[model samples]
Target: MTLQSVLQSLLTAFNSLGRSRKLLLIVLVIILLLYSLGPRLFGYGTYKHRYQDPNTACMAQNLIDFQSRIDNLDAFHSGDFADAVASKRMAYVGNGNIAAALGSEKGLYIRLNRALSQPINFWPVVQTRIEGSKKKSTVLDVKSGLAYKMQVLSSSSGCINVGSQLYAHRSRPALLVQDIRIQNPSTLPIVVEMDQIRDSGWEHVEIADASFTINGAETVKYKIYSSTVPLLKSDKVIAIAIASVSIESTTERVEANSIKKFHLLTAVHYTQPMLAEEAPKYLPDCIQQAKGELEKGLGINEKLLRQEHTHVWGKLWYSGFSISHSKASGAINGDRINRTLYYVLSNAQAPLHNVMSTQQDKTNIEKILYFPDNCYSGHSTLKSDTLWIEPEDESQIARVVTTWMITLEKLGCKLMVGAVKLTDPVTSVLYITSDHQHMQELKHAIHVKEINEAPAHEHHVIALHKHGHHFGGLPTIFWVSIALLIVVFHLFLFKLIYNEYCQGQERYSRSRYSL
Candidate 1:
């Protein structure tokens, strides 16, 4: 009964306007509602530019590694998975009991040795048998005259038990088993000594005290053997890898100091159905030991040493060396199964002038793995989060390129980053020091991989959810705006109907009074 009542009466009169006026009011309410949703619809494009660089290779590795781990409940309970087990490489409890019960061609269990996109069907491979006319038997029969074979350990990163034997879990003294492994496939009764294994790749043709002329000109000749059979000069990579094993324990103490320090790290594959059972406990304990001893990592002997993958670096650059045999092409392609050298960047104190005139141009260099502050020589299931030096501009690159062949000496992995000596590149080898000297390089590269800062994916993009919230008790902004518009339209329609009804009632009262 005051100013408010007078305004209400005026508002009712205005609401009694025509249908066109009512329609305009509804349209106005809809426009206001849409205004609330405007920002989110157009805000996406502004946050999409942080992931465009070559350093993205490291980023890609990080992304794929994470994707490999995301739980797909749909796949597991659906019964569509297969598991592969490498038994020869399983746990070893006794001194000589390291070798397991044997399987067909290779071991009691074949090496999963590479990362498969999905769980592999080992039954088919295990059941697979060679035809009588195939290579193994045929080759043996053909060489019946007076066959000699050799057994080699290509490379390994395992815990070593040095000195004597053991007692309980605490008994085995740990030591670095660089380039070490037991030989089940070795050409039975042959030794591929440690010295020969150290000088296996093309990078060190110059480092070797003695050289084997491919033409076999001299009697003091150097040799290349696979298992026991000496290889012809033209022998292939697969042949070399098959006969190689990386053994650490028995290797000379001097050589042991030359390899890189081992780090305990996490891999994406740790969550697989096969790995899930063991990885949870084994991975952490192993990583913890490695971390505790990072200052002085303790490498011990375990039958499962090879299976658990330990990290180590090359003391010297020897990419293609074999201890027991020649390498095979198949081995090179499948290096990811047992990834070796983890690439890193170094802020080497080395000067810029140290860089060569040729390396001045980034385009001219063969490849740039770690720049001034990058780490991790490269990556894989086995060697993740391992660290190394970043190359200074010129001379360092020259040094690695001029004298290197990418080797899987530890896990038989090859050429993780820069080109090995014989590796084909338009430019000469460009080196960002891929060694373990620089700690900063390793940290930065790891940070990139962990945060998934690379790639133009949803994860990398910034989400404004934290800041895009509503205010004043609003219902998620969008909902509130929609509700407000409906309220506005209903109120306008109600006023129109109420005003008409009120006028009719007043007229009826006036007529009754007149009567």
Candidate 2:
């Protein structure tokens, strides 16, 4: 049809429409025009909101001004997780051989390793109870190697505040210490009942005794004023933990506006008995070493101990890399990076003096190299044409793979292949290394995975399907629904236009006939 004729027919059809339908048509046209040009007309709004808001604009400047104050205060602070008596938020503190996951509610779980052997688990080293106080907050200071918590008991008669610091001694790796301070800020004396009950797992325990010998062996004696709990058996004990509470009284009367102090200590010792004959000698040495550590740790002043701990951590920070960010999201990411470094370093130990310099150590270098593996592994060799797969989230896989790459580079191993495929919540990492022996050892040490000769991308898809995560990036149903909606909208618009044109043609024919 001619353009003029079509325009005339459309205009006539629109004019003949009912008032409501005409109004609807006008609204539809306006909507369509706005949809086409809205971004161009209002694009400046985003810039204005982001740059004009005082809070957002000042974030970077504020971070710069307060950067130094927060440098040594790498802490995870939480105030809301301390409501109930049993409320717990766990934070980890460790020194390579010994690690503890402590809850905000004064619960502790320990893990002990001997000569890089498998770790032994010890739960609830000592149960803690406070009669009349509620937890206020918990702060895990990674830089200082301390976990701090505050509790307050308030009543009409008096107010009492309790602050506690829990830390793994940096100087003495096996020592764990807790300091509690009670402050009474009232005219009346407040009677506080605090108890550190020994765990049920601890058998043949003694509280008041200052020392204990394990397995009837006088040589294997621990000289701590606490109970000794041996794991495995008395004769074949692989690990032992000593726990002590300094406060003799279950209830302490705090004088008006005064303070009372108490402390708890736990020491762990373990030995790797390679042969049956070595158990006796090694067990005694382990106990003696633990005793010496406790004695030395106890001799140091509390303030000095904290200073030494912080100094050690300061050295770590100085030696390691630093991350800085000015934007809010960048700041959050920086915090996460610091925490990740803290976790890895907390469980790492420095090399012994002259250990790395010796020819024997050089020959056993592979045995000395350690990598944290909490995910899957697969077997492959330097000359083998095989793929190693790891099933984990993308971020976790990235971290693990990055750690592996760094360690492997230090060992002079070439990285042949590294690839990652992300399928929403499930992610897979494929790696091909030039060191087959190292890969095989790692496979045996960590969780094992199936070796896939298929292409990396295809294997990832297969793994995801096996895990019931078939949804790729977006759901298939979602895209299908979206397409269906678009089709229906176009069909409706076409039908409306065709009906208007048909009605207009009929009227035109009738008018022509009448003429």
Error of 1 at 213 (Å): 23
Q: At residue 474, what lDDT does model 1 achieve?
A: 37
**Candidate 1 wrong stretches, greater than 4 Å:** 1-58, 70-306, 309-478, 501-515
Candidate 1 — number of clashing residue pairs? Answer: 73
C-alpha RMSD for every candidate: 24.3, 13.1
Q: Write the per-residue lDDT of candidate 2 for residues 168-263, one digit (tens) a residue.
A: 666566777778788876688777666555444554433334643333453222223233334333343443435343456668788887988765
Clashes (backbone N, CA, C under 3 Å), per candidate, total 73, 3
How do the predictions measure up, each by TM-score? 0.21, 0.51
* Every candidate's lDDT: 0.26, 0.51
Q: Give the per-residue Cα lDDT of candidate 2 at 377.
A: 30
Cα RMSD, model 2:
13.1
Q: Write the per-residue lDDT of candidate 1 for residues 1-515, one digit (tens) a residue.
A: 89999999978976997765766676776766567555557563245446543322322332342232223210001010112133211111111101111122212111111111111111111111111211110000000010111111222332111111111111111222222222222122222223322223222121112222223442121122111111123231111101111224333332331322211111011121332223334443433332332122123223443222211111112243332211322222222211122100111111121222244554434244334322324334222322222222222222222112121222122323443332111211334555763323323232123422234524212222222322322335567568777877797777678777987789888999994
- lDDT for 269 in candidate 2 is 65
The candidate maximizing lDDT is 2
